[model samples]
Target: ARNGFVVNGALLLDHDEDKLANVLPRPNAVTNRPWAVLGVLNGDYPRLHICDRTVTFGRSPDCVVQLDDVHISHKHCTIERDGNNGSALVVNHSSNGTYVNSRRIEGTATLSEGDDVVLLFDRIDGAMHGKALLGQQRVVDGRGYPVLVGYRVISVNLLA
Candidate 1:
């Protein structure tokens, strides 16, 4: 909470680090913690959790986070915590490709606290990254566009 500013959906990195934009959110008490997002594509995880073990995302049922949409490959990618630090890495190899902070990854990408992981990708004339609620479209902005309808989470007080 007393770290960075919570802009769109996640934390904002540019604000003064000495002052907090808001308070931290209390956990929902669910095993599903942070980083298990992409909820809009398949109603899976608007909110995600990054346990010690590696979590997989794809169209297959075996994936920890399975997305049913055809755009997703049978076995797309994996998100594992990068040590005890509050950071992660995404390994992607989907047919349609996975987006990290709105940029397509060649093979892998490092994920920070405020980064976004997008599964359903369309034509990206140009793109911008912003925090989004679950994975819903209108849910969040698309590449080259501003999507403005989501329940952004800054803290318990900022949840819409």
Candidate 2:
């Protein structure tokens, strides 16, 4: 099975593949893991990978970012725990503008359901999903298993 997940419409994958037939998440009657919201940039295989608690974006092999575990390239973005709200992932806009719901989000913003998050990297747009937001993207090399990113909305129950 592939090791990865989706968040805010961004399809996070584990490997670099042009075409993956088993990228989407499979339906589980038991565990009932929350579904991730995903968005894709323009390309045959445009997906991010979540491995070892880090998120690797794009296929260039150099586009990688650390989410909650180890720090990779600080040039991308920062996902930190909200001091005021323990249930939200506070996305800080770096040199590249971090967009939420197609709007450029400055400073720190709380993410809710249905929110679209686009990490500004040229022309690529990364969308967000929750009960409040719902976006979809094709995931590659997912092994038909859900890629679970710990960054989840605290206010909304995505599974419910």
Candidate 3:
């Protein structure tokens, strides 16, 4: 099916070392100030939510953004906005991996608006993406899911 092919195609990029994200530079955290707002979107939870001091994202019920799916890990990653400055760093704790803008991050990356954040990309498994899909025509036919297991950074610091 198209969804399977789309998901599998994204997996292929992970095999190439050179294609992955380079070592992340140490985050220049400025203060304990939390980000004013940040949005995390996916198929199920398409509505954006605001951020707090730090958010642990994974399958665990304790995680602020709990993604209870097969592809997600218990403690997959954490996106922290610890400084007054406008910077949010995502630290990967899952062996399965995390990708920002389609490039796998071995450590962390400061999120930017409009970045595609895919979690556990290898296991999308054709699950329906709900409202986070594209292609009006394709959607009506049951193939409207995104190309990966992910969320969209819809906003950062309240910026669209």
Q: Which candidate is the best by lDDT?
A: 3
- Residue range 1-160, candidate 3, lDDT tens digits: 1222111112112223222112112233333332434323323322333335466767776565556467679889887763667576778989878877657799889887677667744323555353533433222111333443456665576421
How well is each residue in 51-109 modelled by candidate 2, as lDDT tens digits?
A: 12223332233334333222212444443323343333535435545555455577767
Candidate 3: count the clashes: 1
Q: Between candidates 2 and 3, which one is better according to TM-score?
A: 3
* lDDT: the better of candidates 1 and 2: 1
> CA lDDT of each candidate?
0.45, 0.35, 0.51
Per-residue alpha-carbon lDDT of model 1 for 17-119, expressed as tens digits?
Answer: 2222132222322233443332232122234323333666676766655555566688888765555553457788676677765677888787654455676
How would the candidate models be sorted by TM-score, starting from the highest? 3, 1, 2
By TM-score, who's the top model here? Answer: 3
Q: Please give the lDDT score at residue 66 for candidate 3.
A: 57
The global Cα lDDT (0 to 1) of model 3 is: 0.51
lDDT of 3 at 56: 70
Tell me the TM-score of each prediction against the true structure.
0.52, 0.36, 0.56
Question: Positional deviation of 115 in candidate 2, in angstroms?
Answer: 1.1
Total backbone collisions for each predicted model: 10, 17, 1
